[model samples]
Target: MSVPQPDSDEVVEQCENCAVKTPHNVSIKLITESNKEENTAFSREPYRITECSQCGAKTRQRMNDA
Candidate 1:
């Protein structure tokens, strides 16, 4: 139940085409399970939530490997 987020000092952005600016209040939730990780709830944890302001289309992508 560990959820990550952007810093409070960070600013929210919107789609460039919309021309309308608003907070990225939208959320993208994701969880993945694999046979190899038998007992785990999710093998692939979502890293980031990307959202579109105008149409509200969203996507979740894995974070970069360190």
Candidate 2:
């Protein structure tokens, strides 16, 4: 059986205010990137911010593979 992969339609995270692992509003965008030839462009990854659907607390996260 194949493991179910996470799709763009899903939002998974823990809310500090609610103190539960619930679905949240995840916003992703490219913050900064490296232009050096040797450095991997993936190193300067995008920001995966999560917002609580309950209390609406925003949290910033560095997503390396996002």
Candidate 3:
């Protein structure tokens, strides 16, 4: 079976593997999680998935609301 690939945009960002700002594929994903307490509503958070084009290293970072 073939795996589905996520849609990403090319952007300039810091890459850990390259140790410098480089071109990377960035995708935004919304994560949903349930609260530990009972009868609580689930929380939705947005995160950015970054993949370095040069070294193929991947990283995830939470997106904060300003």
Best by TM-score: 3
Model 3 ranges off by over 4 Å: 1-8, 35-41
The local distance difference test score of each candidate is 0.52, 0.68, 0.73
- lDDT (tens digit, per residue) of candidate 1 on 2-58: 222435533356545455553454444555646675756746665677665434656
lDDT of 3 by residue, 1-66 (tens): 222233346887767777777778888987765556663345767888888777789998889766
Global lDDT for candidate 2? Answer: 0.68
Tens digit of lDDT per residue, candidate 2, span 3-27?
2333566476767877776667788
Error of 2 at 29 (Å): 1.1
Q: Can you tell me which runs of candidate 1 are displaced by over 4 Å?
A: 1-11, 14-22, 26-30, 33-37, 64-66
Q: For each candidate, C-alpha RMSD in Å? A: 9.3, 9.0, 7.6
Worst 10 residues of 1 by lDDT: 1-10
Q: Please state the error at residue 8 of candidate 2 in Å.
A: 8.7
User: Model 3, poorest ten-residue lDDT window?
Assistant: 1-10
Cα error, residue 65 of model 3, in Å, equals 7.4
Candidate achieving higher lDDT, 2 or 3: 3
Candidate 2 deviant stretches above 4 angstroms: 1-10, 33-44
lDDT of 1: 0.52
TM-score of 2: 0.53
Full-model lDDT, candidate 3: 0.73
